[model samples]
Target chain A: MPTDVIMPALGMAQESGKILRWLKSEGDAVEQGAPIMEIETDKVTVEIEAPASGTLAGLRVPEGADVPVGGVVAVILAPGEKTPPETPAGVEPMVTAQVPPPVQRTSGRGRAGRRPLASPKARRLAAERGVDVAALAGSGPHGAVLATDVESTGRGRDGSTAGVPRTPPRLGAIWQRMAERTTQSWQTAPHFYLSREVDAGRLEAWRASTRKRAGYERVTHTDLLVKLVAAALSEHPHVNAQWHEGGIVAAEEVNVGIAVAVDDGLVVPVVHAADRLELREVTARREELVEAARTGTLRPQDVGGGTFTISNLGMYGVDAFSAVLNGPQAAILAVGRIAERVVAIDGHPEVRSMSIFTVSFDHRVVDGARGARFLGTLADLVEEPAGLVP
Target chain B: MSSPSAVAAQPGTRELTLSQAVNEALAEEMRRDASVFIVGEDVAEAGTPFKVLSGLVEEFGPERVIDSPISEAGISGIGLGAAMTGMRPVVDIMFGDFMTLVMDQLVNQAAKIHYMSGGRLKAPLTIRTTLGATRRSAAQHSQSLHALVAHVPGVKVVLPATPYDAKGLFKAAIREDNPVVVFEDKMMFAVKGPVPEEEYVLPLGVADVKREGEDVTLVATSSMVYVALDAAEQLAADGVSVEIVDPRTLVPLDRETIVASARKTGRAIVIDEGHRSYGVGAELAALIAEDAFYDLDAPVRRMCAMDVPIPFSPVLEDLTVPTADTVAAEARRLVGKE
Candidate 1:
């Protein structure tokens, strides 16, 4: 049986990588798990291991070529394998591959699932492009395919099916899932956005006093907000609910996933039971996550399972913006920068500092009233953070 | 300060300028390897833009030291073609600013050909260009454009500071199978050091520690190397010892050396001649923050040229490029002294 070598995602958010070095040469016999190539994505270099033991057949993209996630690069034909599948002429290879379906759906076209013999991602790519995988011969390791084979064959991933789309799509596993889930959520759920501009006057004064008292060792506003959110979520557990097929599954623990923007994409590292941790602990955890994300070294534990989430673009000077709800998490709170604005204080126009927080929720689970109450409670806690202590 | 070996390893042993060392390296490499030839403007009979290739034509025959028409694009193209044809051609592109004209040839052709062709074609070409403000060549000629070449995929960019590295690294570039761009500071060429007479090939993508200290790690490339070393000395006087590192090649950047230094010092400041905006200094700052986050006591400070083109006026040009004073100030800032 031919084994497919897909593009290995270097980091959690990396959809693709540039081939920096090729360790193996054509005709060189390679073993499974052997380092065959070095790829650089998001400034970090990672070695790509060979999948199946076989003689190196072909390299689709040369070193230094930027390929999308799930796109194939090389092929290792299975021993005794002959006549690599012929590609449809004139089809260009996609930079990225779509997420593989849970099960192979045999679309009448015999070419489904066979992207050229490049990497594992490339193989999944054939199916995503709707190319006939079976008809396309792989030119990679252990009879695996490559992306160029698809390009060389000239057939779109959908395998000459009209309305299946001839224009090649560059989609990765996460992107495919993100798009599907986002579109589905938007279409079905009645998403109502509730944005509140809260006066952070007292909080700012408190933070300033704390910094002076602590001798220049100051904590960021995000740290204080995380504490406030944790307390608020505890008060309004209804907003922290997730939508399931049968019913709403309200999570028992508060695992607040903090969304960090890296060079590639978004990676949310969850702080488990944020309600139980101190402000210092939250700051330290967030710092560690940001570092890990920036360096492309985030562990699997850093990305999985969250009941609530927070994304801050305040540091980048962004005034206000909405964020896509990271599925499974019912609500994602977006925080913007604090600026001075005119407000009615004691029935007179007074300058007060305020910051906007926009909350996007899975309307199926979190109702507008629930989200509003959560934000209102969060605003109160930030104004009076002393109440956050147990 | 302690041992003879340690004392002998110090970067400055002679007053030879950066140009003199480059000339020595070129002459020595050409003499040692008959396959080595010199190309580019004024490189053969006219010497070099900085006179780094002055005596090569007199020593070697015109075939090995042939001059070409004034075309920066043509110079690199010929070098790349000849390198592909199996000749080690060292091209002097005169100015770092002029290299912009041949970006396609350098970045697309020279850098990608070997990798794109899957190692079928080898381009053993050396591009020697002068970088930095010397008598204010302005935006056209005087500029440290290492970042441009370093960002390219296959090309190895060598910005050697000392005479020893200039000789050793240049020889290494000539022998390397890939194309290399040797960026030398016009001012540093006159600053000499004692280079060994024996054959040596200092591998690219490695860093050299000019001075070792415990307070902060100072990483500077090319001419900024001397400024960093000088800052270290000044810092040492004030009870702050700065460890200075020069990454000889930027492409296969030696992360190990940089990270180790950062770890030791607990604070880091990167100095580069490139502009401060998204320059090599930014890359180094990110690298240190990523690897040595816990070790860092403060944010990494970068001393680079102001985000402006090198001006024609001497005062403006001097201010634009990172000076010794600026390097020292950044060093102090890294350690929280400023």
Candidate 2:
């Protein structure tokens, strides 16, 4: 018997997976459990192994084809088995024709027998919208009337009701997911923002001295804030909780996620148990996570199980900005650029390095007073860097 | 209608193979009711070649789980006679193709006992059988004959696709007053799914929407439910959304759910493992067309096995049935996506 190599379901809601490339070609002898192809899902790219040890035959879909989950992309035949005459019945060919064959209809029929070939939905919509189905040209198979045709009639060109020419931009999977998540968070989560400005004199000093060290040369302000935020979260567990299924559930670990921008969109890779790690270890993990995010090679563990998140746009020269909550998580800390400011101290002018920190909280989980206290603690730690780093 | 997540969301749910689930349902029901007993061929020690009744003989003893000879008609008659009395007898037919031999006892005797008696006497019998093809069991053993019994008036038929449905529907079948026949896909005995630990039963004559969609409705049964689901996923990539409705029970079929889905989608395709002519698909397509005619965009289509015997050759057998590709292609054509 031959074994089918199917496109496995990698996620709960994933519809299809794109085949990146095949490691082995048709008629190649392969061993079971060996990596045969790489597939990219919405979240990660993973290697698919050969289901059976045999000669790989009957390669159905080619690389770059987005095969549906559980669709047979190839087959593995036994050593003495022969390939079937045709592609197996259920295996979908990726490049089928978009248009269907013409239907054979009798001509010379009157309006009584020759009713308009409109779908039931199309007819209903046409009646509702007061559009004539006979005057519209359909793009559906066999040129049958469709709902879109009815909707576009008496409208602007190409179905644009705004009377303006427009073309929708195609987005990658990552960007599409980001758009959906941000919109969902904004609409669903009741957000409340708290902004605080703290003197960044000690934070800048900590980064400078740490960068001068032998192994800490690449440490940035984001790494320092991750360390301080993890400490503050350990003290105030309420802000580290998530709003899940209409209740507040506290996370067990203080895993902090850092938002990093990539070529396509943004990714939040987490650093597990940040409070328990030393500053050097935290710096090393942060650098590794950022590099992985940029290269699109972050593993599953690097992107999941985050209790709190931090998004810092300070490096882009922005003063301050509030961010949407990275949801289920109750709060997110947004950091702005650090600049020199003149302030009155004891009736005299003094120049100090200052940075703004804004925290967005899901009001369902964290109230005003709890969110204010958490930001106050984070600001205090940013001003005084005594034993918090160690 | 139970969604896919409802079973898993239950507390203390555990994964069990379809065989294990059936066995557990039988054991629980036998323990609950003293009058309940199972009778079939090789049921005691052999466990009917699938080991579904492995521990039942030991737990309930051979007297209750009686093993009879290789006689379908004789055992069916005995089960009918026992059911006509006060006892609740469960008759296990090994292969659905052998339903031909026991047709007189099941159709003529068991199905008509209560009705012929004018509700004075009752026949509470549950006939469990296996249905499905492509097992290479040759023409004698591989056949989906649920449509045959469903054609009759008094016999109730059910086809369970998943382990969760199998256990729940089987228990419900045993408790019903009328004669209910359960057709389990022979190829799906090893398939695993979540079954709740708590006691529960799924009422007959209810349908489940396995996957919800907007474009086309694919009404599938038994093994074909998985096929339709696979095709639905593939169609989703081509921008066609396919919804799948599993009619768990054939007789007293859930017409409202199937018609509502067809009315919403405006297109429907019925897929079954039985023969294409006068099969389950024909009945469902006729019902949907009758109820949702104006709501339909295209004629209701039927996808079933070719009107021929199940071939012995693997090559020919693969071509006789409707697969995911065929279903997807048919859906694409119906929704004008092709």
Candidate 3:
């Protein structure tokens, strides 16, 4: 049997693709899964692999021809099978005007009933970006579609709300756990909030000047808080303790869980024994953890044993927010963006760069006074800036 | 594991050797029903070789517990005739190997009397046979041949691993109207286990979960149940909980209990005293595959006795049979716990 190769829809918005070049010519022996041709979609130019191994026999679509996404481009014939006559006389490869958007279909990775096989994150991203995951062939191990495979660039998603609840395609394992855990923490833990504004004028300047210094990449506000929070927890171990049936059980060391938002939900990767690390060390470790979280490769050790947590929406430009307690962690600090604001300094109106910080505590373990003290120390450390430095 | 929550858990419970349990079950059944008679080779005087029916003839008298001639075919024919003539006869095949001599009486007559006679004749006969390996009993005498009878249409095969199961299953077998072949492990005769003093018939076709666990399910038949339980304990120390299900009867095999446990754990290891190919393990593995394929994360595994005949040398004999260590190792491989 001859294997038919169809053009792939590169994005959700892509209805057709233009044939760029055929890597293999007619009558050429083709190995399945090897790059056989290149097609230019509205967004990307990708080399398409052969759907089956055989001799590339028929070239129905020619180069520079625009064909429907699902239109057959060529056929691979078995060794003894007859090939159709070459690109017959003056035949136009142009898709007819009456042709509708190509029906999404995936070869080599077609699941039963055409459901498509994709990883959880990939499924969720495809749904959010309106990509037809069922149309794309999987490229991951065991034919699993990854999140990166959901190309939103040319997916034709107009960013219009469907007038229905805009739910993500899938919650995935990470988000499913997040929903159950956060709800349990909120419903069971007697949560009380603490908010404060700190003068971040000096902290911001220090980070900017440090970036210019030798051997520095980028010093972020989160890096400074990670260091300060670890120091604060060390000074107030009660805040680093877990609430148990017995009572407040203080952790011996500080392992801070930094909440990062991925395609699906918030994943907190722990920086174990953060108090022992200097500012630069904390920055490097935090960056690695964040990258791992984004790539969905955080190991069990990367996320377990969190005694405290930090949720920063500063990069998203949020003014202030309250974070739910993560696991048995007695407290979690929510950091907001720093912007210049007019404030009264020693009874005089003054303009200064300030940032809002809100901290939530499990009243079962951390009392109002202790939580306030921890928050006060953290604010002092961040405002002073020098105290956070190694 | 400690015992069934009630009888298996009762305080002051006395231990009975598996053979003694068999003797007790027989005596109890014979006393309850005058129609329940014993007729087998040397069963009346010698208690056959395992002494499982010892003292039964003295208590029930020679008329009811009649000893039969040496020929297995004649003995089986007489047992089936008595069963068809409104008497429940317990036939003891001296060795599992000798059961072949009585196959015609069992498979063609005893197993099919009711079916062939269209309810006019019912063979309420129970054939008690011995099976095991590593007893230093040579090939012919040490074969576990329950599968042969179990494969026949109307025969119910019972294999009890513990004293508790021995007493209960034997009673159930005596009460059953169809021909039930009870396979008693030769090596298990002297093994002592908790048995309730009260008479209770464990329902045939029911499987007992010797140990409750979550990681993997191990379905063991006959003597392999003990091996599986031991393996479960060893796996427990490594943080792997193995559920051990013992199908007391092979014919009316409790596929539900076995498949349920397999589905719950997503992995199963079947241990049987018979050969690995087309034997008890193969049947059980096929059962799980057909019914619980999607539930499995790995292929169902089987650890069966080596296909070679039962060897006379003690070390070789031990190697011929499935062991606890082998069972645990297979369970680990099945569940990837290793």
Candidate 4:
């Protein structure tokens, strides 16, 4: 009989481990108690030994792939035994095998047991999302797993939520805000859209050179967009004003909300006073805010008091998309990718770098002509932003 | 009845007490090499009171099996000088407590000569000593101080629990060019085991698996090896499989065998006859905890002598040291099989 080499649990919270290296090659004879592989998990490297004396055969879950604790990674076959003809690409071979039952995470909130220390809310969130709460290291009060911990661990894997739900719960603070504000804005405000294509080739090149010359480690395209949007709003204040109590309220502070999408919902952390700060300072502040949002550590002051918001899907390879008004804000700008496109140059076709910027405005607050004018001004400023910097 | 795996196999077998095995090993090495000699207080005339060096003087003659006065320092100094001058001298310290009398010679001279002389001189000496409580020998004659010798550098320490290891490891110790300390369990001198007829040498610094099972790995040294084996039989009747590993040599400790067995089993129980604190079990427990912690399912447990002096009363004496029943109980707790 061939002994199954299951992925060893490397820690109390480790459900799986990524194989860092394989010391023994497949089809090689191995002693019963020899190190066959090294696995890295939870920042620790653990060497795993073969379970039986045999020939290592049918390599599975190749190096750099993670295998769950109970999932078989490889097999040790007795002498003269051949690799099974029907062995799947990985062990626990056979894609048609009966799916194993869901692992019942130790339940109950009491301390001093196998059950992990976690709040009821965290447990509920993990259950709804189908996440293993025990596998997460808690960052809550006294290291108790919280709802936010589940969300961050899910996002860390970036859509590799193999066992997580396809649809998360629609009840977190961020989720409720999206539900209430979008519903209120769509039901009450008269909305209108205006879009314009801008050539951003010069802005992109200027940003690259500026960062290299200044020796700044990170200068993103979003920083330049915030500066340009702030400049355009200064030229056209109506686009940056809020509609409150049936009156136009122009914001004294140009606090632009940078909408960062996390695993479960989107959080809009503000880059306060964007128009006044230098480009590098804006880049630094904006980077800090986005990091706080992704790590689920944003404080109230970070997310409050936004006059306008920018939702950029450029990183997702999207050409353009529309965004709903975050309530009370006059408009939300949806920015798309800068890619080479065929366009008219004096009636002759030419390839130039272009991007789409669409403004979703509250029609009750700003008329069609004013919204169109705001987009046009924004396009001109973005195309030639040498004057906006410092 | 002993478990089948608990009894290690030998090629050609004969029964011998642990002391007889040591005597045979010493005689064989002395005959094989002319430079090999024995020197101690009662080693030549009275044969160590335990008869471990009984007939060596008659065979090798008085020059090679030289007797000495009650001066441990003087005796140990001569052994170190002989070793440096290319003689493989085996110095027997009649009792372990007298190690204090020869501390300077043993630690500074014998242990540091090679390093102090910048490798120009080597102390190829073997010091034979006895440890463990024998016949309620009280605090003086009864002590397991292998930890003290092991803590010193430039010295290899060996503790053999069975006759087979006593014979094999003693021969290997004589062959090593570095200073090696062979500590036998004083209480287990009469313990018998199967010995191979032909000469054989078991390498130092390698652990032997006295028993093999899957449930738990018990790492024990010296007399505790027997305690652990006895507990293995007890646990076997209760349907718990246990594996016992004896780390024969302490200085160049065999961490590979001990850690591998613990990782394989995922549960480790360390049993030692030394004191509970600052003893051999503490070191082994720390090693396993640091190296194989993730492989453990339950906490690593230690079954060591209570942190107190060995008592004179037999009843209290048994309580001071780890027993078979205590080892089995610890195993059950660690396995969560209680």
Off by over 4 Å in 1: A1-390, B1-16
Model 1: per-residue lDDT, tens digit, A298-365? 65566666888898998888888887777766888988888898999899999988889899987888
Tell how far residue A171 is off in model 2, in angstroms.
40
TM-score of candidate 2's A chain against the true A chain: 0.74
Instruction: Give, for candidate 1 chain B, the lowest lDDT window spanning 10 residues.
Output: B1-10
Put down candidate 4 lDDT per residue, B1-338, tens digits, no spaces. Answer: 12224445566788888989999999999999999999898888688888888888999999988889898899889998899999999998988777777678878888898898899998889999888763688877777788888889989999998898999999999999889989888877888888889999999989999989898999989888888888998999999999999999888899999999987777788988777788888899889887876566556788877777788888888788888898899888766667
TM-scores for chain B, in order?
0.93, 0.97, 0.95, 0.95
Best by DockQ: 2
Ranking by lDDT: 2, 4, 3, 1
Task: Note the Cα lDDT for every prediction shown.
Answer: 0.73, 0.84, 0.79, 0.79
Location of the lowest summed lDDT over 10 successive residues in candidate 2 chain A:
A104-113
TM-score of 3: 0.53
Q: Would candidate 1 be rated incorrect, acceptable, medium or high by CAPRI criteria?
A: incorrect
Candidate 3 residue A349 Cα shift, in angstroms, is 24
Off by over 4 Å in 2: A1-113, A154-390, B1-10
The candidate with the higher DockQ, 1 or 2, is 2
Candidate 3: the clashing residue pairs are A11-A155, A12-A155, A13-A155, A13-A156
lDDT tens digits, residue span A265-365, model 2: 88899999999988889989998998888887786678888898999999899999999988878899999999999978799999999999999999999
* Chain A accuracy as TM-score for every candidate: 0.59, 0.74, 0.60, 0.59
Interface RMSD for model 2 amounts to 1.9
In candidate 4, residue B303 scores what lDDT? 81
